[model samples]
Every structure is written in structure tokens, then in C-alpha cells.
Target: MPDTSRTQLKQILATRYAYLVRRLERITGSKEGATDALHETWLRLDKANVSTQVANADAYILGMASNVAIDQHRHERRHAHDDDVDVLLGVPDELADPERILTARRKIDSLKDVLRGLTPRRRAILLAARVDGQLNREIAERFGISLRLVESELSAAMKYCLQRMQEAGDPYTDSRSSGPRKF
Candidate 1:
């Protein structure tokens, strides 16, 4: 027998175009989407290998149209639209600009200068408590000083750094200023 399935499908599509469009519109929820699906179905028919005969040509064509619509939807979802690309491009970069980077370097240099200006004992106490992550009690025992003296030295060092930073026109906010250092 001839490829009657393909021929029958083409005839049905040509004859029942409007009816199929209405049915597909209901299935796809939009006239434009339904029209596009039917057009895609027509294009796919030329490439399809219909070796076996179809018992129900209308259902077969409708099923093919539905598959085409689903495939179209999947394809569209895989690629970003122009508006999506524009929105992505409009997002601000997280990296600091050159001027911000220079300002940050200057602030760091100012902090280094402030650290260098501290007395050796005070600097050592501050570095031990803050940078070296030593406990105040441990620092006091290591330096042969009382815990009260350790706290006093750490506090003075912090206040001196804060004053120097403020005078340099870039104040550093201390988050732990609410209470004494715990660790």
C-alpha cells in the first residue's frame, strides 16, 4: 500500500485547518501559539517517516501538533530572550572600580601607619589579641601582666587606631565597641 497516512494527514490538515486551530488554541491557551504549532507541524510532516498507518488521523495530527507546541515551549525556555539578556547585562558588577580599589588601598596603608605608630608593647598586645587570636588572660600571663593591664593596653591601642584613622579622614567602625573583647 502507498504512504496513505502522510497523505491523509496532509489532506486533513488542509481541510480542517480552522477546526484544528481552534482545538490547538484551547490546548495552547493562545491563538498565536496555536497557529505557530500548526505551522511547525506542517513543516515537520515533510521530514517525518510515517511507515505505519494511523487508525485515527485527526487524533494523530492533533497529538503531533501538541508535541510540536511542547517542543517549541521547551526550546524557547532553553534560550534566554532579548529582554532577559538586557536585564542580565544591566546588573551591576560586584568587583570594585579602580577609584574604589585605590581608596581601599589608601585606607589599608593608613591602618598600617597607625599600627606602626603604636608603642611596641601596646602593638604586641593588640596584635596578640586581634591578629594572633590569643585570649586576654593568655596574653596577660604571657607578658607577666595582670588581666586588667591587658584589657587596658588593648583598649588604648584600639582607641589610638580609631583616632588615627578618623584624623586620616577614613574612620573605621569597631563592631565590638559595645563591650570588652571576649577572646
Candidate 2:
């Protein structure tokens, strides 16, 4: 309400504004983000009824700027995804933490060793049964084999493949059963 108080606020803001902007820029590493952060800081300070409590106003502004930048960085980190070609080598997009990604990659590579030893026919049949969700009768009919042969072949193939995969140190192991269980 007083002219003198309004003049004092204006002077303090003008002197600290550039410093706030620069600190924000360093935190965000972008001019646009820094400008937005500065605007948000000014808005927050203006809305609060406690600006008079600020003894060292510049330090207070810088503190706000730092907190805003850290929050923004954390938000970005949460949504950041891997776009590298290495993702083609088999990385789990669900796991964003670097150690988890690296462990998933190692597991994939280890499984590949087992996949290399698998017969193409068995691999195709397994993929069709497991991934394509085909019935054993359907897979037998599609592959032109008897149902008995489908069961026998899948069992033998899975036994060999699972043994190899487990020995290769794959963290994710595929389960095997001798015959279908009625539950």
C-alpha cells in the first residue's frame, strides 16, 4: 500500500533477477528452462505474504532457483529413455536405471548363447506355442506333425534348451513340464 515499500521491492527484484536467471540456467542447462524457472520463482515470491521476512533476498532467490532446477532435473530423469543403438542389443525399456539395464542386457546375451544351439524347427515350434499362444493340436496341424510328436519334440527340445540356458547363467529361466497339468 505504501509507495516506499513498493519502490524497495522493485529495487530488490531488479538487482537479484539476473542472478536468479543465471543460477537457473546453470541448473537446467537451457536458457528457455531458466527463463521459465525465473518466472515461476517471481510468481511464487509475489504470491506469498512473507516477502518481508527475507533478510538476504538474493540468497533466498538463489535457494528457490536451485530447488526448482533440481526438481526439474529429477522429473526429466524419471521420464528419460534410452535412444541409443545399443537398445537394439536387447535392453529392457521398463528398467531405466543403468545397472538394471546393463544386467538385463547381460542376461539377454547369455540367453543368446542357448538360442544359438537350438534347432530352427524346435525354436519355431516353441515360439509358435509360447509367443503365438497356439494350441499343441494347432501347432501340430500347422507344422504337419502328429500331436504325439509335437508333445515329444517340445519336451525334448525344452529340456535341452532349458539346461543350456540355465548353464549359461540366464537370470530369467523358462519353466518346463512333462505334461499339461489340470488345475
Q: Which predicted model would earn the best lDDT?
A: 1
Ten residues in sequence with the least summed lDDT for candidate 1: 171-180
lDDT of 2 by residue, 1-183 (tens): 244443555467667777667766777888888877666666655544553545666666667766766777788788756664457757656658889889888877876667667788887777777678888899899999998887877777777877887787764665743456221
- On residues 1-183, what C-alpha lDDT tens digit does candidate 1 reach at each position? 145667778888989999999999988989999999999998877777767788887788899999999998899888968998999999998777998899889888988999999999999999999899999999999999999999999999999998888787774555455676656
Collision count of model 2: 0
Candidate 1: misplaced stretches above 4 Å? 1-93, 174-179
**Global lDDT of each model?**
0.88, 0.70
Per-model TM-score, in order, reads 0.45, 0.42
The model with the greatest TM-score is 1
